[model samples]
Target: MAQLEQFTTPVDAVVSRMRALDAALPARDGVAVFNRVYLTVTEEVDRRVGTGGFPDPRTAITLDVLFAERYLTAVEADGPDRRPPACWRPLLQFRRHPGVRPLQFALAGINAHIGHDLALAVVDACRSLGCAPAELEDAYDRVGDLLVSLEERIREELMPGPDLLQIADPLTHLLGSWSLERARDAAWSAARALWALRGLPELTAEFTDRLDAAVGFAGRMLLTPLPD
Candidate 1:
């Protein structure tokens, strides 16, 4: 129906932009690496939306687009006057470091997005849809589940071989210290808290700033360069 197509237009536009970025950047570039992972996830979400996988397709599409736009905005904020959010600064700054492995790049981006962007995206969706955070929970959980399912695949594809990944490997410890499951949990909590504070603009802004800084610190630690 025309209504369904109207709802999906934004999702398609975001997907097209991501695909363009995937083509534009080199495969090993840090932003490109995460962009590929995110593009695939977005495509999957789009497919599911068309197939009735989401009970509330409109909400799912809106959240997916809103969530992705945050990252795309960061990507475009390259000018001196357009700084990215604190949570995204680490990945953009260290994106070209020779000692930072591909897995680190991927996870660092994930941390910035899920830990920081997802919560804000939830609030964005609420405002757009004129609903509460609880109303968006099902769509949020579904999207989170898709990301969680892809995390293992990402690790398998990007992690170094066993010879380089010894039990004492710093990479092993670093990766183990940051779990996608936990990040997703925290984002959900933050989304609820943000929704509760929506009426208090000053407190909401302060809380959001702290969350951004904290997540950025974690991202910085995640991107620590290891010896090649």
Candidate 2:
């Protein structure tokens, strides 16, 4: 957590923490696979924020920080048996599975983070700032666009060579089933729904739970172990 605490900007803190994880985890470890991809995206976002690319820098930074904290909190969980949100559980549980490919790890992590955590993080940012989801939509869209652009590059870099990525390959099918663009769309919808239901805490909680579970299920599918 020292790396997280040392940075003043939310993006900086996240970048530092991911770098630390990338250094600490085995190069081929599932978590490391995703961390390396994510670290690059975050660095790009940070650079964009610095350049005034985001329409609302303050809101963007706030939303980004809150979003990243959810993932980091899960990473730092102290109890070995403690399960995180459904979106996160698969990665945490199957990260070391010998049969899972690096591409699976990368996509699963992206799915969990964008499908579930991003929506919740939007709500968190709104609540913390005494604003509404609409106020933060600009920031959300900016971030989502960045993620969408980087996804192809991530897949290209992480996917096995063409010889191993045949049309009949299960990995090919699995990877094709999940798309960053779709996840981002779902997250935005979920965020809007959560904001609308904010007045009803119980309903909101239930909605959030359902969202987490659904994302987790998707992640589990993404992480399905494949034989070498």
Candidate 3:
């Protein structure tokens, strides 16, 4: 595995990348950074779910995924190509560097955000579902289970390894982020969509919008750490 120091300094590059993609890089850099870091963090959660022994990884992974995905969906709906994919990938790779640990710490913060987002969305959906406290826990569990199954696929394709941090950091972080908290919130959101009475069983425009917005935010965040 390549040492993290092998790559160019990430913090410096973040500045350049953000500016390269968008001239207005500094205005909303925090949200941008938050989104990117959050995405990477969630990806990690997803991975852990599959190859993991953790008891409740599902809920967090799915919940965080949904919020982020939904946020992206919303952003796309509102704007166009706000964040290029190219910008986010390298930032993630830097974080996943074999020798680096700050990215891992940032991931914890990302998880916290995922949990918060999921809890809020779950509470919102629960009101519509009329789900009781006990039932809410059950709802979370169901999604958590599905996430674990999905993680099996991810792990099979890409198990955690030394090279993972170096080669495909974004994807690695993405897969790892799926956990019980995320999955639980996602399940709740899924249920809430049904409560809308549309019988809609597909990704809605709103979800897409949120997903895109989140991606934009992330892209910007990746650039925030760099120098102009």
Candidate 4:
């Protein structure tokens, strides 16, 4: 049906863009590192869209696409003249540091996307769907669960081996400090707050700006370069 196609096209298009990024960037590029992880998650979401993975397929597709576009837009808009969201600035600025590990890059990217972009994306999806944040909670949790499931696998694939990741290693401490579960939880709270403030444009803008800066600060800390 045309109505279904209308809802599905954006999801497919965003997945295509991510796949293209995966192909174009070198394996070691920090953005590329995050792209690979994101692409995998997006592909899984796509495959599960109509297969009962989502209680409401249409809402899932809308939220997923909106959530992914924020990151893709940051990638597209990065430059000296253009500022990506504050939360995204660190990863873009430090993408090529030799001392920063792939795991750091991936998590920093995750921090930015979930910490800042996700809350806004929920608002965006709610507006597009003519619903409220609470209405989208199911879809949000489903997507968050998918990310949580992939996170451990991400660590296993990208983390340095146990021998290198000693108890005293700074990387170990840094890794322990940030948790995806916490970020996802905070994002839900922020989304609720943003939705509540939607009627007050000035307050909404200020809260969003503060959220962006705070998330960016966390990302900068996550990207701290350690001696090799």
Candidate 5:
């Protein structure tokens, strides 16, 4: 496993850590389930970076790496028994529950990362680059586009078979209410809002807390355990 500081490229380091997690965790574990989905997205972003898909490669890498570090840091900081953030608690706490399907796990993780972590990551990137949110808009949109595209495929791959999934199932309604595209759009908006309000630490902190709580509420809903 590569330590966070070992790699010069932030994306490379994130990809390495995610891959290591995939290898170490059981396939059905909630974190592992999300890691697999996220790993694919990171790899694609890395490919795009190699192929010159972004206008600013350096800025793109910086945003992508810093964006990922937020999640990695949370995981690293929370030892096996420690509590994660409100946004992460549902997935982490109910990871091994038999009633929680893979789709739930995947979506819950996505909710936490995209809705909560991504916004903060944007602010983190802005501070690190000493640039405004508008400056990083291209990189943000490109990364978001990748996530939106993959969201469908992840649902299709992880959802229970049609025969097994009934329309009346609560999971159906819960999943329907959450959209990755919507979340991505909202995250971008929140990032811009945060950037705009950075000068007012109290306001920024309040907005961030509200976002975290909202995302956590969604995660808790997504993790609603179903009957066998």
Candidate 6:
């Protein structure tokens, strides 16, 4: 077997703790089970920042999305490649049931920044939580929906409003631009929010630190313009 040490995210520390959670889940097929675990995580930023969600924190939605994408990738340092195609596109789409959409979404979001391999680890973490990959999917969706709305609202209020695509082109669309201003604001807001979320007890320490560090790292990237 390949060594897991190659995986860079701090998630390794938390994976052990989540084992108990995984055991409680009922039997299910592997691929179906996997989808139940990763979707909808990326959508939180879309809901929260996309609409100019936050104010005091003053964040740029576009930038936050970028940061969020980076954070998702951190956990994937080395693992199986299971990233699903974008809702708009699909190299090979993973399908999850309606109840499991959130986890799958989150998984998709995380994989967006890194390789698909890390997604397997995410499933392992869910197992430790006493939830099947499916349950984690449900849990994450509910959590992402509620938190993202509030976070996005607060984030928009914190940062001045701007469009990100205007500044740089999208991977899929050359003509479309990503607004640099939005990227700066979103990255900053996400960093601060991550810093604050670090204090919460609901998440394991490993999960918190890995994501927190990722936010800071990505936020720093926002400082530099995307290389031409």
Best by TM-score: 1
lDDT of 6 by residue, 1-228 (tens): 122222212332233322332354332322223222322333443344335443311122222233333333433322365532221011113222322222222323322323222233333333334333343333333434454454344334322224544333322132122222333334334333444454575654554445434533432222222222
The whole-model lDDT of each prediction reads: 0.92, 0.84, 0.41, 0.92, 0.84, 0.32
TM-score of 1: 0.97
- TM-scores of the candidates are 0.97, 0.92, 0.31, 0.96, 0.91, 0.24
lDDT of 3 by residue, 1-228 (tens): 143233223322433443343343332233343444444434444444445433444333333344444334332333254542322333333433333233332332233333334444464445544553344565355545544564355345433366555534554554354454453455455445544534443655455345434533543343233211
Q: Pairing residues by index, what is the TM-score of model 3? A: 0.31
Q: Which candidate model has the greater TM-score, 2 or 3?
A: 2
lDDT by residue (tens digit), candidate 2, 120-216 = 9999999988998889988888888888888888777877786774533888888789888888988999999999999999999999999999999
Evaluate residue 110 in candidate 3 and report its C-alpha lDDT on the 0 to 100 scale.
39
TM-score of 5: 0.91
lDDT of 5 at 52: 71
Which ranking of candidates, highest TM-score first? 1, 4, 2, 5, 3, 6
What is the alpha-carbon RMSD of candidate 3 to the true structure?
Answer: 15.9
Our model 4 lands, by Cα RMSD against the true structure, at 1.5
RMSD of each: 1.3, 3.7, 15.9, 1.5, 3.6, 19.2
lDDT value, candidate 3, whole model: 0.41
Comparison by TM-score, 5 against 6, better one: 5
Q: How many residue pairs clash in each candidate?
A: 0, 0, 62, 0, 0, 54
**Can you write out model 1's per-residue Cα lDDT over 117-176, one digit (the tens) per residue?**
999999999999999999998999999999999999998888888778552289888889
Q: Which runs in model 1 stand beyond 4 Å of their true positions? A: 166-168
- Candidate 4 residue runs with Cα over 4 Å from true position: 166-168
